[model samples]
Target: MPTQTRRSPPDGYYRTTVSSLAIALSAPAVAQETTGPDDGEVRAEQIADERRENPVDSIIVVGGRIDPYRIAGSADLIDSEDLRRFDYGDVNRVLRQVPGINTQEEDGFGLFPNIGLRGSPVERSSNITLMEDGVLIAPAPYAAPAAYYFPAIGRMQAVEVTKGAAAIRYGPRTIGGAVNLRSTDIPADGLAGYAFGQYGSRDYYQGQAWVGGDTDYVGALLETYQQGSDGFKTIDGLPDADTGFERQDYRGRLAVHTAPDAPVEARLEFVYGRSDLEANETYLGLADTDFAAEPYRRYAASQRDAFSGEHDQYRVTGSLAFSDGTRITATLYRNDFARSWSKLQDIDFDGDGSFDSISSVFVNPEDNAGALSILRGADSFEGAVRIRNNNRVYRSEGAQISLERPFEMGGARHNLAVSVRYHEDEEDRLQNEEFYSQIGGDLVFERQTDLGQQANREAKAKAIAFYIEDRIEIGALTLTPGLRYEGIDLTRLDYAGSDPDRSNGPTRVRQTNIDQWLPGLGATYELGDAILLAGVSRGFSPPGPGNPDARAEESWNYEAGVRYRSDKVQVSAIGFYNDYSNLLGNCTQSVGCSVGDIGDQFNGGAVTVKGLELSAAVEPRLSNSVSFPLSLAYTFTDAEFDSSFDSEFFGDVNEGDDLPYIARHQLYVEAGVNMGRAAATVGANYVSELRDNPGSGAVAENERIDDRIVFDIAGSYALTDKFSLFARVDNVLDNQYAVSRRPFGLRPGVPRRIVGGARVSF
Candidate 1:
């Protein structure tokens, strides 16, 4: 077992009296709540089996189920057991521990994930490729990638993140890397089922159950999760309206041998999700002073905001095995999503027809204090409020086929793979605006906008892609080289400000095509007892249609790392550099960008991102019935703009300025004790200060989100072989820290919450 040294605490004064924990008024938290790891790096069985093997041995990992030791890329695996240990219902909270990925909490609900991979823009997770069951899962990957619709992480079986040169197989946003979520596989043996539920602060509630079984010729699984909450923030003078959300998710799968003796297996799956929310969320945020005074308060202007949405997916998959180490797998899939949000947009506080966007008022509060105070019900104001009904419908479907074969040639071994995919996606957006007259903090319906639609447009893309890769091995060295080809036809029709129904005007249609070849290579060498790896890849992300001169976001990405593995300990260190020729950002209406429609793009000329990641874990062999587990992860990233350019979203930027919101340093630590059927774990996380704009030395008070440190603890006790009691507490420190400085002012992290529940298997 690996050993660790502990240091004693420094001598300090001890206060005579004690309190629960330090909490910020209206700050909503007592913790930094940084993400850490459990036993979630790999599958429980796989990790156990590999622990007994040589560290340098090649074995399939959860990342594409590819052999990690043989690949030249960086990958991280999040297993199911780890999810249970962390109670990972929030994707942003858990992914924080995964180095190279930066997360910004939007609305604190994990409802819409905003993540940037190695310096990609952290908006709606549009810069990276998102997949489920090894298939594309975004609402519209090619046609439009902004304003994403994220998946619920509570029900996922595993999450596989592959970065740098290793992500060549996935497109069209290869520059940021890929996140693939693997769903639970149906049982191949006897019946199995489990159910669990928990209740937390702010009326939070969660419950889920799943059952699966297999027969001689058929296998089936059924699962459902229903969760909801009455939100934390209350609106002034409107105590009756709840400010939270509710959602129900269902998934089912059936696999049939069809011909029991045939060499093929097939499965069909269906996934359905629906959610309704009456939230007080808005683009408006408090000023620095106001935040310091009341960080959790909501203004009266946004009392009427609400949202609702639905998503559905259907897929058919099959696999074939041949006699000589060859196999083929294929899938046909389709997804549909629709959403509508009714919220306040602009306010004419003085009835002056000269309206100010709510976002502007929040971002520049010092100049808009009069209007801000009036909107907060501090003073009377005669004005007309502008409300926009934002609605959109999306559809995506695709077919993919892949082939794999292994053979030996010239005294060496080689693994070969080939695949082809055709995908099509479309987005239809039609929105309307309604005017209201405000008197005494209450709104009276005035009239609908004479302009047909606040936002009206459609985008579509049809793409064909082919990929091939070869892995060659000689002695203790392995090399992999891969290539991918993408050809896409994109089209957009803008009825901007006109009715989508063609009732009020004509439409302007535009078309564009993009073709590119992306290449990647990786090498791994097994040393005396350690593993050395290196890789380089060409990354690509295409611009949406309608912009004839919009160049694709391209980069040369490089990575190198080393790893050591054993039965009791594992460690790894990796470094990556991404040199970008172009970076892209889209104006999102939700973020207060109304210069054009929702899908407009702005290009940032040149950028560079370099980072380092370190990780270690140890599980010492203690007594026959007791053992301890500890793990640590750290990240350091230096991201900056290489070219001086002006961005509509980020304002002005000079060369050498740090990119917005990319934390320079992050650290995570976790320790746990296991005694037979009972287990306890505690963890802490720290993140350095982050900036919202490019600036010189010190982080300007206005452009900075303060650093944070958070803690968490959880325990589970098994009463029998089939049942267990569990409890958890988050933000144990109750530290108040800024999680985001976008969409307006500071948005706080999740507040302190305690939950207890039971897990039962039958």
Candidate 2:
């Protein structure tokens, strides 16, 4: 298996909300619950703890940033603290619960998980906009780049996701939405930090410190973390894989607040991380449950492998306040990344007997004198046979800018934001001797050997976009309306490879796509402190044909919701519907080129998705001594393909089939208990069955996975004001499932596991 690019951040909130509610619900379950910051920066050298659990239902933004509530679109927020709670094995799993989100996990951790939102997968860059600290990360607007790195929550506050046109404030690529990760506040005084743990050999460590002086440049802030864990799997016939994983995160920042009366500020920020872990291989789904239970004898061979990768992202941001409530912000950044790996597999043909390939020796045929040679009758071949090799390395650099203005009226305030971004990425893809082995045994093997080659392809793209938004506030009402425009030029030149000849156009092609406009709107209402209401302006995703000159994709969405809360209770309910045009799906093998003739092709079409999300939470004291907290969330979704041709590739999938990966129902319930210094909680999340894909490639007919329920338990005890002990157990009951299902049908969920550890502060 190969190492993948940074997965989504562990900052997703599902686990934290469930865990907290579970402890609150237990009648006599005594435990403590906790909350962490979700906005602003940590002072230099200040150790900050933050979490974004329950991101979609509970989140607030200031400074005229994106407004998630008023936009009728769908969105969610993940806090930093929640990310620390899990073993942090796979970040994508933590994000799968968000509405309109789906994942593509090919051949396990060896490949990056591609994100799909609403009905738009990451395949086309024309729609979705991905940002870090408000800067676009992808080098190209209509093209998808594996996200660079997952920033540790140790230095972050929360991740806000704005879906649909409501996300227009960020720029043109936001047809589907935009993702913004907020940085933690910088401290002014000194140093701080915390620690915690769970079952499954999991542990967490973090620390921070600050230094500031008066009448001079304020240079302050330092933060670091070390985390590791052993994993779970109790079933037989399953690989006793080591859930061994480790991470190191470091950050330093310097701020200069000169001329206290002036509204100008400058900050220098740096971040770095390295990770090493075991890559879990997924079992391709078997034909039947009974078949899955049996370890069919193989040709005396099995396969196993492990991998690791490292990344670095650095940036400098400056803020300047001009006259008349206008401000300008800009950031310059560069990201560096690298990864390597290999696999060992025992081969068996006919499922009857195991035999070493005589060919393994042609390159290094050294040892072997046995019945095996005699079995081949000695006349056909000679000597040694044992192994095979597979190995690869990839890297990029980018810059961004934005401006904003504010307006106020009748106790209400409004802020408008606009921005543009550009990036240049160079990629190198590699494969070795293994390529020759696959086509070797044939009669033309000699010719193939002579044609063996090693090469690289350099792809460069330039994307530019600008957008404007108007936010209005009047008493209990907040309204936001916006529009965006975008343009791109993409070109690929093969240094050691030739462009395949095509019947419709020149074999070597050059293209460019430009759009003058894409528009959006959003609004929100507050009914006192107990009830808040909202709805979005619109949602859209434009398509991008792979050719630089292809047409752009497009889509629109509508949504409405409300949040009701008080000191003792909180409830949120939402309903949404989306319409998509020129939606992209599995393209013909000629387009994607990975699955042979089995893959579908991309084409212009329409799709609709409608769903409802409802959640409620209560905090009530039992009798007069015990406190209980309870919460529940459920989802109902109906998504389908409207009208499309290309039957040779899609078959009968048309008009009203549910979109793949969008579960019809997802429910979670939990409770927590608190008693002085000790506390505990338990919760369960149930997901209704959903298709991993709309069935594509060779496995389409035999593909179908089922609904599953997973239970989790966690607790922590405060030993002293400066120290604590904590532990958590996940996948209780040892339920077997998969966070990702492989193309061959294998289910790969983490096995039952436990993690525990301790922390201290000064």
**What overall lDDT goes with each candidate model?**
0.73, 0.46
> In lDDT terms, how accurate is model 2?
0.46
Model 2: per-residue Cα lDDT over 697-720, one tens digit each: 333423455677888777777799
Top-scoring candidate (TM-score)? 1
**Count of residue pairs whose backbone atoms collide, per candidate:** 7, 85
Clashing pairs in 1: 30-733, 30-734, 30-735, 31-734, 31-735, 32-710, 33-710
Q: What TM-score would every model get versus the actual structure?
A: 0.89, 0.71
lDDT of 1 by residue, 148-212 (tens): 57777877767878888878877778887988877666765779998988888887877788899
TM-score of 2: 0.71
In model 1, where do residues sit more than 4 Å from their true spots? 1-67, 258-280, 378-383, 450-452, 496-498, 503-506
Report the number of backbone clashes for model 1: 7
What TM-score does model 1 achieve against the real structure?
0.89
- Minimum summed lDDT over a 10-residue window in model 2 is located at 43-52
